[model samples]
Target: MRIFRFSLLTLCLLLSSIISFTLYAANDWYRPPVAVSWYWQLNGTVNENHDVDLYNIDLFDSSAELIQRLQASDKKVICYFSAGSYEDWRPDADQFAEKDMGKTLSGWDNERWLDIRSTMVHQVLLRRLDLAVEKGCSGVALGEVDSYRTNTGFYFRQDDQLRFNHIMAEEAHQRGLAIGLVINADQVRELVDYFDFALNEQCFEYSQCSSYGAFIKNEKPVLNAEYRRIYVDDKEERNSMCQNALTLQFSSILLSKKLDGSLYKPCR
Candidate 1:
């Protein structure tokens, strides 16, 4: 009888462990819902007055107090930072090595493609993620994860980008913060499960919005922005786009190409 009781107790403990692990695996991150309203302003002082479900703002430029204030207003904050590129104007710009720098981005002359495989670059990104945690951000928006598809000067293939992106996602999750994929639609299939949500630009304008449908299928949010002038200036065109965006189940917004806090037109 003693041996039988001991075995039963051990089985009960094992079952409890399994249940705990499953719960952790299932909800280890904050997954944004489809069609959730969000304000995207990464270029200037964030206007926290927008009544939305989420706010994607600059990680470095925005202060810890601002994040707390947004949280106080019942908003989830997604801190934005360029994880896959090296910006010359950032406060930690001097920490990057010359060898780690690559070709300039097509339109943004001040920003350059980063060697994502570099340990030095990874260290810098880790520090940035730590900063997001320190500031009490709910999630992080990692920009430029698709530099492999650009003229980045580095010969980064799909695997390289995937490994680097996984590292970023893992680091964010480790700190109990969610992470979003930014405009890397090509790798959506491989990365959908890794990232909590997506931050896309011009997917509709480029006819690539369908590529992000996988997120909707999996019950994840695809926060999108269309910078086309017609969508911003013409009410008819904007309504038409919003109609399609609703059908696609995307959280769409209209903004200027500059991404300043000035222009904001939600599709809902």
Candidate 2:
């Protein structure tokens, strides 16, 4: 009888362990829904009246106090950090190894592609995630994740990209923060299952808005930004874009190239 009782106790302990592991796994798989009051600019003060559901701000530029203030106002704050590229202006830029750095991004003069497979780059990104957590961000926006499709100068393959993306999701989940992927519309189908939501640029202007429907199909929001010259210069085009954004069910906004807090014309 004693041996039987010991065995039963051991089995109970094992089952408890399994249940704990399952709960952790389930939490990692779950992602919170977002509403956009997103601002990419890191230099200026956040408008208190934006009344956005989620605000995406630079992880390095903004303080924890600002994130807390937003949260106090019933807003979720998502910290924006570049997981795939190296920006020279960032405070931790010097920590990136020279060998891990690749070709300069096409339009962004001060940034360069990073080798996602490099151990050094991974360490740096881990530190960034730690920072995001410390700042009390509800989620993280990983930028430039599709280096496999870009002129990365690293000869990276699609499999490499997939592995990198999965690792990113794992890291974010481990830290108890939701993870978001920002990608060009072309890679949406390939990465739809992994990302919590989609942050798209100019999908309406390029007529590739339909490609991001995969995220919507998964019951995730698609936050879009359109930078058409007419949308900025002409009021009529802005009104039309707002209407189109409503029909598409995208939380669309108009942002300038500098991404400063100048004008955030949301779709009303």
The TM-scores, one per candidate, come to 0.89, 0.86
Residues 124-197, candidate 1: write the lDDT tens digits: 99999889989999999998898888879989888999999999998888777899999998999999989989
Estimate every model's Cα lDDT from 0 to 1: 0.90, 0.82
Clashes found in each candidate (C-alpha, N, C closer than 3 A): 0, 0
Please give the RMSD to the true structure for each candidate, in Å.
Answer: 5.7, 4.4
lDDT of 1: 0.90
**Root-mean-square deviation of Cα positions for candidate 2 versus the true structure, in angstroms:** 4.4
lDDT of 2: 0.82
